[model samples]
Target: MSDPVTFALTVLALLLGAAVLTALFSGAKALTSVAHVPLVIACGLSALLAIFLVSKVAGADTPQFVSAPVTWFAAGKFAANFTIAVDPLSAMMLAMITFIATFIAVFSSGYMRGEHGEPDAGYVRYFAVMSLFVFCMCGLVLANNFLLLVGFWEGVGLCSYLLVGYYYDKPSAAAAARKAFLVTRLGDTGFLLGIMLLWKLGGWHTDLTALFDHIAKNPPPTEQITAACLLLFCGAVGKSAQFPLYVWLPDAMEGPTPVSALIHAATMVTAGVYLVARCAPLFALAPDAQAVVAWAGGITALLAAFIALAQTDLKRVLAYSTVSQLGFMFLALGTLGAVSPVFAVVAAMFHLFTHAFFKALLFLASGSVMHAMGNVIDMRRFGGLRTVMPTTHLTFLCGAAALAGLPLLSGFWSKDLVLESLQFGAHSGHPHAGSFYLLMLVAMLTAGLTAFYTFRAYFLTFWGPTVVPEEAGHHAHESPSVMTVPLIVLAAGALFVGIVAEPFTHWFSGFVGRTPSIGLAAKLAGAAEVAHHFNWGIAGVSTLLAVGGVALAYMAYGAGGPERVPVPLAGVFALSRNKLYVDEVYEGAFVKPAEWLAVMARVFDLLLDSVSRVIAAVPRLVGVAVRPIQNGLVQFYALSMALGLAVFLSFVVFRAGR
Candidate 1:
């Protein structure tokens, strides 16, 4: 009963209890309100526990805590156990999840309140699901073994499906939930296969620590390791909304804004990034798999950024931005892993840490704006909101700046580290240098695009004449203190989290396990040196790109610019607006074929039914033909028997003659 273990289990219990209480009281108003008390208390306690664990981890040189394993089940050479492990990485993630979730819960208390300031009927359900989601994310982060990780991974996915379709009566919301589930399920399938492969390789050992140690001591074949890594990364791709499987995320905006914030910022989306970082040891053995991850991330970053540029819905624009930002994280992981495994893992986790704060702020701020505009998220319909919602505007601007990677903001430090990693990879003379160089160029371009769309949404929403739609009524005002306070807190983080980038990186290096190679370690040290020195050339270029993007946005959408531009590049605009027709392409390729298959299946089903009917008719026909033979009259039976006997005798005589 160590303090750390006690605290960890206590946190888990509190969250589980919160979820259960809310579920139980969902139908009773007074009881539901009482239930929320425990929910908030659980959130607060979890945050405090997270802080304690993070402090303990950061203060110690060797920060590892593992609970005594409790066997859940056992079989020959195979067993599942319940265990919790906390190290620097998991500690940091736990801190971030609980902390952000606390604020979101507090903010939701206001945002989800009824018109008269009472809790809504569904409020209890929302908090219940939210609490459950927190528990699942914690489980995923703190799991000592891959089995628990996968279980919690699916748990979070299920919670997301429930939360996203919270408004089940809304057709769009229901459809979005299904889409998210099905799309991510595709990746989970690959993840499951990878797990099985690893389990077999390790002789049924699935404990992550033991598994990694085995792989490091006796490295598997290149082909096997590469295949496993690729399969595992497929889950990351879908969960994090990478290329090909990213269609679900944009549509997921149909959920409540708090759910969006949670998904994008603190919980579900981040699970993928965490998964890759957690398995950095396995990936280090497979360079080919790392390269695939790098390319997929780079391309997704560019593609999603371009798509964001033409989006009009405020939340949808941010939704695409999240996809692009996630791509950058993977790019960092991929490039750096190939050249410098330790730094790559650190850099990826760093970006994930910083992204949670700013992205959450942005989404919540958008929710505020939507509230004032009669729930209208279309940027084309509203303008000049700064005067009415100054707090929201300022907070959103801060978040937007950070997202754009403007110098000195949280995004700049982490994103610059990623870009510098790519540069180092290209120069490291690795076999993958050419691809690394190409990816670096793509990442840099995506940086500029990121800036453009972020500010584009900002300018169009807050600048120009105040054009509140008539349908919204006359009173557009600042959100209540409950909502505004979270914005302020998150805005401060967005502004200052970059300041600790160096120390954070150094600290993170200690937690990602051992370096795979001395050569790789040397390269990583060099990358760290470059980052420490703050390469002015790289910073200057990135800052210029960011500023140039903002300037271009201002020119096009600022007060003096045309309210509606009549651009001549209609085709390009159309393509960007249509998300480069990726959805359409998927519809044609996968959806249509599946539909055709379904139709063919139906035809086969019908034909089988018809054949079954024909087969069934023979029994009925025989029964009908023999119906009169079963009459209960004794005389009739005797007469029929006599006639049958006579006929039988005639047949016998004829047969004998023949």
Candidate 2:
């Protein structure tokens, strides 16, 4: 009955109610005008609750509020509970989810409206599913148990599938939905298995706090913990769109733009990072798993950035950018985990927070662009939008600068923390210093690529000659105030959120209960006294790289530049443009084999059916042959009985003779 718990319950209830109400009234035209009312009320209440919880936890030391565990099912020592907990981490995530989701909902109100300013036909359903999406994420952040988290995790996945394929009639949209669903399911299977393994190996308890306490008090074997952590990371890889499983995310752009923003920014994709953070206790015991996570993240960041460089579609560029940024977060987690487990979690969380603002801003701004341009998202066809949509142009520029990790932007602060964490690991006398150095190199290169591609998209979209398609040219104009307002708010966050980096990192580190140790890099470089100080050298290197990238982009795509700049290595550009044929590789390796197995299964099924029919015919044939023997006549029956007796006597005599 604590205030925080009460507020959280109230928030959950209101969101649940809004979801139910919207779904109930989705198909009712008469209620379309009022469908958003419940969501508005729910969002407002949730925002207030989130703020209250965050304020309560902001200054408190080790502040954690947990609801009394309600046993859902119990047999012997095995049990599952319905519980909720909010510490600084969960509270922060709750605040961001509610706050960002509220604005996105408001933006959608304007964006999803019909051409004539009426509500779209599926308007109610859109709001309904969106509200449900928010509810699921809330459940996830508040969940105190693994089972609950998994439930909410799958709930968000289901909602994403629903929202992504909202336009069911569009073949691409439907396919994208299925792709996202099946691909994530692959990781989800691993996640589920990990949970089961943890339960079996550690204890029967599924409560996260309890499980962490158990694992910490009585540490398990390295192999067991490592296997569990790796399994859990598989889910993260799929959900966050890491290498090999990342193909689904770019295609997910087929959904409505708001849905895309939600996925990329606030909700599903970030779940993997949160999972790792939540399970830091486990990962701390599994160094091998931690290395795998870090390597996967680093590799993904570089690969996705390269792909983004060659993408022509606005959303696809952003999608790949999201994948790359997520990789950066994982890399931070992995590197820090090696040097300081607590710092790794904090660093990753910091990036996740900043990324939410800038990435969401970028997506919404792109939506605004699409709105004005009659849904044309091809950057090749867009140019000089700054002259027409100044507000959107400025807001989008803020987002782009932040994403590029320009000095003082939100991304600069977070991304540097990641790099610094790597530096700490490289010089911390860890056995894997060489590997950390290699990761750092890749991360630095990815940063340059990020800046290059982001501004490349920006310059192509807003700075060149005004050259929109003829069909959309006449209609290009600023988006409505509703949509632009969110952009402005998010842009402000992207610009100013970096200022709180020190306080936020300090608070988060304390909350997680582990302070990062100073690495040997400061000592080796003869700056041990200022080891805790900001690494100006690292910052300078990253900034120069970013500047160099932006300059290169300008030279290539700025006003009056070449129609198509000749790539130095045309084959490399071609490969990048084709996503290095990763999809084709998967199709040939996995998909084709799966399809062949399915065909073989179908042929086996047909053969089995034919054999079964042949076996079945014998009984039918016997029945048909014996049908005439059952004649209805008392005299015939008596004669048949007498003949039978005579045959029996004959048979008995023959047997005795034998």
Candidate 3:
């Protein structure tokens, strides 16, 4: 079918509606709660993947897609389109969101089995939210209009809030959710403004195909286009969590591990890049806006990479890493056409794919450990878990290697591709690019820091003597195959995805509409082997950095166990320990000022309302004086009417002359 949007919505509607109905009709004991949910999602995920594969390849060149707009309301001028239209980009995103979500769903069957008092309360709630989340992401990416996308965008954000605050009993968890929502809303205003500008520029043509169709024939005024670009960037920054607006991601770890895995790693955070990719034509003409994007993304990547280096909490590190990685994606978008936009987009999207696998793997492995050790995530409370939980330790190590961008891992291919694009970008003379060499140097350094910090976390948690009290759990063992299987699957994906990057790149090109770049060495190696012919020196240097970092971490933290680490760098190491105080700086700069402005708004409203009431009373008091002037007298009314007539005539005469 040409109509991917309609197909996706129908699919989501069926999946969610069926899940709810099953929950109702199956009764409490018949379906056995969350077990039913995982099974249901498995079925839905499989169906969606089948559809995505069939549709993505089928409709690569044809735009004869049918519109199946389900209107929420209809008015003369404004009506909402629950519009779904899956082109290549949308199809690809749908595949990712559903696939990873399904993995989390399946993995959770075992991980979440005993979380709440009821054997499956957490999974049941998680499934409902997760299914809704998948629906939102699919709907968002496939939406044919800005309004439709916004509806689904906000839907995804809403689920982000709910899932983040899933542990409502934990005040910190609830606060983290609030923080994320509030911070994102700040950026969403820009997104809305951009949408409005877009509508204004091309009224009666705001749908995706229509906008492209209109612009294809006639470009809008430069001012309108630039404004739209800025506004969209605002939305992107908010959703993607960049630069000034990125304060919330680190705290996002307060959510459940699976929630963190799904929401942050795979789906919600990538929406911004999808938006940019979908509307690349518009952004292509907005040079100034692209420059802003480049600077913002470059600074964010460099900044967040360093912050991630200093974080101690396992998931927080990944949170900052996600933010940093997203910056790299935006940076590529900024340099569009410099090095084929298709290549950039493919690299970014592939990174998104690989990051989802490895990041989710890391989070779930950490979850296994936390479950084993009574929810202890502090790296210092762990050590030498190679024996106790071989599966988790090995899985974490594999995920860590992938994340560190070592050789043939999925992350290595994607990340280096992004960097290579940035490296070659400036030569193309796009105003959006900077000195490629400098950017490459900066990127290389960031890679080193990323490797170091990631390995530090890995080593402290699983490579030394057991720092966990010996009595923690004699049964502290490997998780079930349900959990380990997902890890294995992700690890396998992470390992070989790079080796086959060429095919993935080819598959991804169905969206970006450009031929994939052929790195000669890569092609010669045939996508089946790791070849280091072109940039062997860079590879050796970067690899050395990672290994060195791991060695240092081993010396410092892996001595015996976590307890042997230097105490000075422990506990109240709030600055380095808390990620270079970036959060504090943000609080001091933006959050506090916003809070103050809110307070001022409240105070101003109170004062203005009180003054307005007092002014209103004065008019009433003056009415008493006027009443005395005309105390029940028809003669007084007649005199006042005559005076008013005379004044009106005089004013009319004066205005005519003037």
Candidate with top lDDT is 2
lDDT assessment of candidate 3: 0.71
Could you give candidate 2's per-residue lDDT for residues 504-528 as a string of tens digits? 4554445433211112111211222
Worst 10 residues of 3 by lDDT: 516-525
Give candidate 3 regions above 4 Å deviation: 1-7, 22-32, 35-48, 51-74, 77-80, 115-123, 469-474, 503-548, 551-560, 563-575, 593-658
Order of models, best TM-score first: 2, 1, 3
Quote each prediction's TM-score: 0.93, 0.95, 0.83
The stretch of ten residues in a row with the least summed lDDT in candidate 1 is 513-522
Whose TM-score is greatest here?
2
Quickly count the clashes in candidate 3.
4
Candidate 2: regions farther than 4 A off: 75-77, 501-532, 560-563, 632-635, 651-658
Candidate 1 is scored at a TM of: 0.93
Per-residue C-alpha lDDT of model 3 across residues 1-658, encoded as one tens digit per residue: 3345445656666656645654463346545554446445544554566356545545556533446667766689877665556555555666666767667777776766664325554555666676677777777876777887898899999989998998888999999999999989988999998888777676556676666656545678767787898898888898889988888877888888878888887779888877777777677666677667767877788788777765667788888888888887887676655665556566677778788888888888888887777676766566778888998888889989988888778777777767766765766666545655667677777777788778878877787675564445555677778788888877787787666644434544444343112222122212222211235565677677767766766676655453343577554344556666777787898879989999999999999999999999998999987877767889988998999999999999999999
- In candidate 1, which residue ranges exceed 4 Å CA deviation? 33-35, 501-532, 560-562, 566-569, 631-658
Residue 65, model 2: Cα distance from true site in angstroms: 1.2
Q: Give per-residue lDDT, candidate 1, residue 356.
A: 93
- Clashing residue pairs in candidate 3 are 5-84, 5-85, 5-86, 384-464
